[model samples]
Target: MLRLTVHRHFSTSSAFFANRAIVYHSNGNPRSVLSALTFPSLRSPPPNSLNIKYLLAPVNPADINVIEGVYPSKPSPTKLNSDNVFVAGNEGLAEVTGVGSGVSGFENGQWVVTGKQQCGTWRSGANVNVEDVIKVPKGASEVGAATITVNPATAYNMLSEFVDLKEGDWVIQNGANSAVGQAVIQIAASRGLKTINFIRNRENVDALKKQLEELGATHVTTYEELSQKSFRDKVKEWTGGKPLRLALNCVSGPETMSMARLLGSDAHLVSYGAMSKQPLSLPTSLFIFKNLKSVGYWQSRWYTERTKEEREKLMEVLVGLMREGKLKEPEHEIVTLGAGESDEEASNKVRDVMKNIMEGQYGKKVLLRLEGE
Candidate 1:
């Protein structure tokens, strides 16, 4: 039998229990298991942890990549598992249904979500340290809060960390229609900056333009259009010689080089992912004369390593934006994978959601359909 030590709250005579999870028994693949195998509960909830009853969790591509054993992050062992296997998910919104003695800033009925790393969040309940979670505003949408991690935070930090773009300065990004891209667009717009967004061609190009425009995009163009000399000329005419200060590159390889080329001198190019599975290429001139900078980002690393006070400040900024309706979670197609849900059905849901996100089928975030909401 599997032997594990958890806080003293959970004990089971049987060797197994159930919690919904996504598992990749081997590399390069993954599937969700509903009512999946479980083990002993917490012997006692950690002294400072608040037992979270999950409200919602996002199904991010990075989460999928982790399941495929492609992402660099590795989950830690927790009492939630029966055989001590892994459960996969990035960040999610929860409620403080139970709190450990001495934990402050949390109480029953308060809404909250993860603000740090190392605590697994896919299942129904979680024992998270008070410092690792942030109290979400009562009026915030659980769906939107579920997306507070990774994309939203990444967009906020990258734009804030890189060169300070003024109202007239522009930011360019690819996977522009991606969730992070959308977040960047909104945040920049709310901050009075302009945006030059690029996206791959999809089935409904016309519809997509209206959507981005509504989100305050200054301009939206396809990859092919961006490669044209005339397009760059047209861009110069529209921007009135003000160069793009930052290029957020998620799908690297040649696109990374192209984004760098589009920036003004002393511009910063931040690379967060390599969706194209291609090497990042750059021209020598950018490094030598233009003084261009390329930075890599992984939100998991950022959240875990940053100080607790820093986390609170970041969360407060984002929540304030949401309160003003300046920030938002993507519109979503929700897929439930919880109690009484079948594994086969849940597997199909995950596959469909992944396809839609990667292929740009849905113009919104794909959330794991949850029970509480």
Candidate 2:
């Protein structure tokens, strides 16, 4: 059996349950600072709350950055009775196991995703307000529902909100093999927009290229190919001399500049991530002559600033596309946390996964399955 180390004290209640969470007391390297803490689950939720049992939570790159204290947004330290630590996840899917007296529109066995940001989803169970969770359709795939909020939403917004792109127009983006990039390709294709994708040259480059092509990418090239002057002529040929109107940059630095070079006059380049950890450097001529507009996108901030109804409307559209089989979930690997595993074992597994993520070798998103569906 898993060795449960109770990290917090709890008051007596009608019924008690055990819960485990991955938390950190201070922000630093995840391997050093992260720990698994077991505590007493709430016996009964408040009148307006529901008892949520996490089903699957994704380990995103941003989650690691948050743990490292490098990300722009931060989760506040939460006091779990006696332990003051921050839980370490931002997105996940959960099941409503118990609903309070005043809670409506939710019942036991319904799947939901947190509606709020910095929700600390990396836990087995918690008491949350009804309004804090968004009900996902019953038929949604675990991977799709668990990951819908961040990468897919980012792609959807970037493709639709920024450029005023239309059918047959070309959109260019680097890190095309990434989850967001894949989503971009699929979403754009669904909207009749073509995509020019750029990825790093790797040992399995051909296979990766083929996979993306199957997902409706118009063109897939390498960063090295993007740097060459001849590539611009090739893009011109591909578009039949049409200007590429929108460019999405995730790998900043020189790659971003190259993406900008592919844009036509009055084009927009919206950057969402900097995976290369390098700053974006652009030539002034492109801006002065081409009138290219540069912008940054943060899906979390969008959720924070937008009205709840507006957010739900956008989610409804995305979910509808998903249900129609137009948008497919990115490939993912499920990391199941065993009930019999110790806290140390769980921590080790998470650390190893995070290391693989840093190395960029996993090739699939990692989802933490706290329990069987």
Candidate 3:
């Protein structure tokens, strides 16, 4: 478990409050453009708003893509007092410090997550509308709640929505060591389905396989093993000749096509991420003869399109799994931000983390822990 040190102070006078945030003035490399800005004083929130003190925020690949100006959706630039800049980060967990007169369904000390992406989550605190955040189950760990909205949701939706999967059915996915991939393995296992996971051969390949198997993965292999014709016979032996009805592909290129070949007739191949930056190529015969269907999934778009009730129900199911110990939190490293740090110091620390993220230095997920209760 991750421990947080809290520093709490409050004043009746509005001018005595302070806040800090990681922001960018222009779209470019995160290391070059990102900076820290501090608000010397904050006024009380207006009616229908709540003062939120951020607890933990995660640095996701999509967040980096947004910083590089290549993502499909762009964050709107806004004034933080006088500077027109974009605040960094999208997903995080926060606590309600104060609520306005018109706000309901929330109170001081309750935890909530940003209801949508690009809400500028990497901050010490902010005043936001009640509808912009969703209350999370207090029983869930900070790391689990902080990282819930993106990867886990993606994995859950892909497993439940793409195909009518049932118990004893087998599903295959590449990039099986990724956060979403791991979630898929556990979630599928909980549903009584089997997973055939493929990952890149790493230095600690055996340890990695053991770790995933402990998480309920039916079978784990490497991309090299997946490419061999003989490996298909091994897959057959493992599944007892059961048809692989659904395939998840995050790493595109030839590796994805190879995985797709394992799917049975009329099966679905869902593409969510292209980490390899390679185009997907399918053999004409496989599409024509097997009637394989290629589809794409984007969780952000799904959140925007789905109804509020539907979203809440999905979250309820996920939270239930967490409470039941059916879902496990992924490995993570915490980056702490002290309350007394200067603007330059905060910027430097955040930039260092960003540089590491760009270089893939963090073997586990990176989450921010801001000071204050």
What's the candidate order when arranged by decreasing lDDT?
3, 2, 1
Q: All candidates' TM-scores?
A: 0.85, 0.90, 0.92
Clashing pairs in 2: none
Task: Give the C-alpha lDDT of model 1.
Answer: 0.72
Instruction: List residue ranges in candidate 2 displaced over 4 A.
Output: 1-17
Collision count of model 2: 0
Residue 83, model 2: Cα distance from true site in angstroms:
1.3
Ranking by TM-score: 3, 2, 1
Q: Model 2: per-residue lDDT, tens digit, 1-373?
A: 1112344232223123267788877777887777766667567887999999998999998899888888877887776758777888999999998899987788899988887888799888888888778787655687888999999899999998887888999999998988899999999999999999999999989999999999989999999998888988999999999998899988899888878988889998899988898998899998899998889999998888887677777778778788889889878899886666666677777778777888887878899876421
* Candidate 1 lDDT, 137-198, residue by residue in tens: 65457787888877888999988887987877788888887788888989999988888888
TM-score of 2: 0.90
Q: Model 3, residue 260: what's the lDDT?
A: 89
Model 1 residue runs over 4 Å out of place are: 1-28, 32-35, 38-44, 338-364, 369-373
Worst 10 residues of 2 by lDDT: 8-17
* C-alpha local distance difference test of each model: 0.72, 0.83, 0.84
